[model samples]
Target: MKRILGLSLLAVLTLASCKKNEAAETSTATTTTEQKDPFADDRVVKQSDLVSEAKNHAETTLALSEPDFNFGKIKKGDVVEHVYEVTNTGKNPLIISAVKPGCGCTAPDYTKDPIMPGQKGQITLKFDSTNFDGIVYKSAEVYANVAQVPIEIRFSADIQP
Candidate 1:
């Protein structure tokens, strides 16, 4: 009976030692993982920083006469048009690079020539609400060589089906 008790005590000691080793290994692994950073070499740039940089490097500044337009109420299959004015409010000339419509239903026309400092330009947006019903919202993006290059003009209308 004494030999049996000794063997049982030895077994218990072995199991307890194994559990301690396992705990030690788990703690080491967790510490190693916590010490490493996934993005250690990479830096994240903020949107406000990018905007500030763009503004700082921009030669010209663009000011929109109207940023939003309301068509009020319109019937289906009606064509609506609006001219949005852009002014160069900086020391340098403003050059419009492109005008992109949000969808195929919108037609955009803009001044091809560069507007000198203190001059004005225009963007003509024509929206056809043939297939659109209910409340319709559309946007046009203007790309220019200015501080606010990609400017969005939003227009909305309550469509009568």
Candidate 2:
């Protein structure tokens, strides 16, 4: 009976040691199998690139007052005003601190106040295509708190001279 008891204790210790070794191996395996960052570009992006990215990020949040705007036909030397109604669909309040046109020929005006969640705003685009003719493509770039992707609200005006 004594010998049998000693053998039983040894068997229990062996089983416990095996379980501990298995737990350690499982932990090691899990740590080693952790997913690595695939796109780990450590090199710092240039200031210009950062600025460009930030500009793009702002653009994305400036949900256009309208998706597609078309000034079908306008005579030369005509100034037209088109309003784009937009809503803040992002997590943060949409701020249209500034709206810069691509060129002086086109002018863009947006709401100065910050648009809260589910709130609406407007961006009016005025195109003075006096001497300009053909298919006029205009863009209104809104500067504000935007998503990771940059947003550019664009419209087109076709002027017939």
Candidate 3:
């Protein structure tokens, strides 16, 4: 009878100890989860640093001498090009970062430097008409540090066989 009581007591104590260890482990997991990002409250750019960049853009202005072009009539597989002038008309310098062509058949090149106030820059677009027929039109978007975020330029051509 005494042996049975002693066994029961030992089992209860072991179970209690196991439960206490599990509770400790749960608390540790919770603490680690809450502290995952200790510096989450630090400074950050929700969208971009462009918020400050906009100030410089606001102070400058840019203009395209010609926003549209016509390649007239051309034979199929002909490669043609046009130069569009960009002028800085504001108090600050104008910077052209990138010029993105609208399609694979069109290639674009532009001034890779900053244009000072009252100065000029050029963007040349070369078009390939290998797979095009009839009347075809293409466009490009210019990214710059001017008042306008992206300036659009377009060109059209009549391709003949």
Better of 2 and 3 by TM-score: 3
Which pairs, if any, clash in model 1? Answer: none
Candidate 2 residues lying further than 4 Å off, grouped into runs, are 1-62
- Note the residue pairs that clash in candidate 3: none
TM-score of each candidate structure, all chains considered together: 0.63, 0.58, 0.64
lDDT of 2 by residue, 36-150 (tens): 1122222333333433534543333445656568998999999887888878887676766555455566666767777887889988877788978889887755546564422
At residue 155, what lDDT does model 2 achieve? Answer: 77
Best-to-worst ranking by lDDT: 3, 1, 2
Root-mean-square deviation of candidate 2: 21.2
lDDT of 1 by residue, 98-126 (tens): 56566667877888887998899999888
Give the count of colliding residue pairs in each prediction.
0, 7, 0
Q: Give the TM-score of candidate 1.
A: 0.63
Error of model 3, residue 6, in angstroms: 80
Summarize candidate 3's per-residue lDDT along 50-149 as a digit string, tens digits. Answer: 3234444535788888999999999999999999999988888787765656666877888877789999999998898999999998987676776555
Cand. 2 Cα-lDDT: 0.65
- Please report, in order, the local distance difference test score of every candidate based on alpha carbons: 0.74, 0.65, 0.75
Candidate 1 local lDDT, residue 120: 95
